[model samples]
Target: MSETKTTVFRDLLAATKDGDWGKGESRQGHVPAYVIRGTDFAEVRRGCIAGVPIRYLAEKTVHRRLLRADDILIETAGGSRDRPTGRTVLISQEILDAFPGDVTCASFARFLRVDPVAASPRYVYWYLQYLYARGDMWTHQVQHTGVARFQFTRFAGTEEVPLPVRAEQDAIAAVLGALDDKIAVNERIATTADSMCDLIFQSRAQQHASVPMSRLLHPILGGTPDRKNESYWGGSVPWASAKDVVNATVGVLASTEEHITETATQNSRAKTLRPGSVVLTARGTVGAVARMVMPAAINQSCYAFEPGRMPAAVLFHMVRSAAKSMLGMAHGTVFSTVNMKTFDHVEIPNLPADVLNTLNGELASLHQLIVSHLQESRQLATLRDTLLPQLMSGRLRVKDAEKIAEEAT
Candidate 1:
């Protein structure tokens, strides 16, 4: 590998602009727009940027400031105690197409358009991510009151980036982009499979008799482990909350953000739900559903449905189809919640034994395929992340990285 030249960030950009800060009223049947605050920066992983679907009405002026392909979106403000400011995502045509109309980030965000002759926007985006992973982004953050803000001027004017030739930059971006492309394709496959299963189940279920949920499954309400007890938290057991179920786009949840100790599960009302248990958000974010891919404990805000005679696959989609009804049952001033009575009153279609047996076999096969795709995506993501820093730093040649990336895909 040849030595890569370095240049200040300001020298590589053709333009830099902060987004519009104006607020818009929430009205019915308006144009959809996105803001930086809505971006799920926490869950964004290598090669995958989560799109914010929440839309608000914005003026035509705001639409003019919408993001373009190859532009880099940077989170300029807002930092948590654990994560500092300065996370960034590269805007691609695919991401732009996901939005119904023109998409733009909030005023708290900024866009950097690289000078085509000087640098590649994709390269700059990857380089910024490399800096973030190395904790260098924190050095460029300015503490204002309690909030951490990115020192955009100082960063743009002073922060140095290793610049490879344009061809090399393109090659690196292509190699990394391939892995991401594969991951995206796998995600689409899984989503399509889930939708197909839902359609199949719905068609068969319409002919069946409506039976009470109690007859199909036992709904076990969750309880909180003592938060103050240090021994109760942070164990190997996955502890799921309503947030986990709400954030999950897929039907199967393999893990959660928090976990609890065995002692905590034994002491509190929390119980370790079996792998096939159907978990749903019963309280705040009511009706969000997912199946437990592994044994896990749930928090008070969620409900775990233990499959009785019904297959887990059937119960999962049944709960999903009933989401609207569950939401209707939710009633609270501050937070919507569904109680035991809500579950007891709800009924699901009971398919014939022979029909159910055949459907269950088909659903099992479909779910297995989805799970396989999910696993492959995880592995591809790992490969991409591992190669990111090395490629950005010029320690690994693009050709060599391309070979590895292509093999992974």
Candidate 2:
């Protein structure tokens, strides 16, 4: 790593206000189209729309500079450095075609105008993503709470970029790009799987009696101990809340963000949830569902419903099927919430025991297939990520990669 030559971000790029770019808000009348920008990167993700708003459109197309296929959108201020920073959507021809009237400019955002004379735009975009992910772009920077902010002006001002030869950049981007494409495909498959499950459950719900969650299973509430107590949250158990489960589509729990100390866990009222227990988010975008893969602690905003005389997968999907209804019933004085009674009265189909077992077996097989493809997609992604920087730097040769791919085939 010591041998790697490093370049500060500011020194390698320039923020050029192409006289053509127009702010999106001004597009009041011209066939409204829009793009969203928010603190959470996941907001732009396929299904998340809780707090994001798509407003207005490009005011003038002819006078304003249009973003081309390769242009990169950079968020300029207000985000935790480690998470999705101001950097955002990489424009593609397909995206431009999809939202022809939409474009974003200014208001604390800037476009990276690559010195095409010096580096390839694709190569630079990849480098920016790497910098964003590694948190190397912002090491020591001041963040003013309310004022327009930027860190390390050098990140936006530099003109000289270290770029691998064009051919190398193409090869590198291709490898990683292929992996991303596969991931996208897998996501579509997952969507299909979810749709199938929804159809199956909707049919069941319409034909079967409706019941609250509490009656079908025992409802357990979680508590958070005092953070000041060292022993409470320090334990190895994972403590989850509505925030933790909000948009999670799969897996028991993600080890990606936030953790509790055993001291905090012990001090708080949060209770431990068993691995197979169904987890339901009870407030603030309530009724999102997931199951714990391991024993973990949950916050009060989340409810752990342990299944009794029910198949785990069947119950999991059952709760998931009723998430919207559960959310609709929530009533709170200050914050909206699904009360325990909602779960207590939640109705589910009283399938014959044999039918329940059959459905469980069928779903188990389907889930296995979905998980397998997802795992393969992830593995391909890991391989692509491993090769990205090295390929970009010419540290690894394309010929060798081709050879490896051949051998794997």
Candidate 1, after superposition: displacement of residue 290 in Å?
1.2
Q: List model 1 lDDT by residue over 1-409, tens digit each.
A: 3657889999988877887654465665556566544256433333234455445655556656677888887888887777878888777887666655666667778888888788888888888888888888888888868878989998888998887777888888888878878887887788889989998999898988887666676779888898899999999889999988887657778778999999998999888988878888977777899988899999889888876677878878888877767787776878888777776777888787788788888888898888889889889988988999888766787888988887787
Q: What is the C-alpha RMSD of each candidate to the true structure, in Å?
A: 3.4, 4.8
Q: TM per model?
A: 0.87, 0.78
lDDT per prediction? 0.79, 0.60
lDDT of 2: 0.60
Best by lDDT: 1
- Clash totals in order: 1, 44
- Candidate 2's C-alpha runs over 4 A off are 1-30, 39-53, 61-67, 81-84, 94-118, 139-141, 146-148, 151-154, 229-236, 250-272, 344-352, 380-385, 388-409
Query: How well is each residue in 99-171 modelled by candidate 2, as lDDT tens digits?
Result: 5365444345555656554556666777766665656555534566644344535555552345555666666
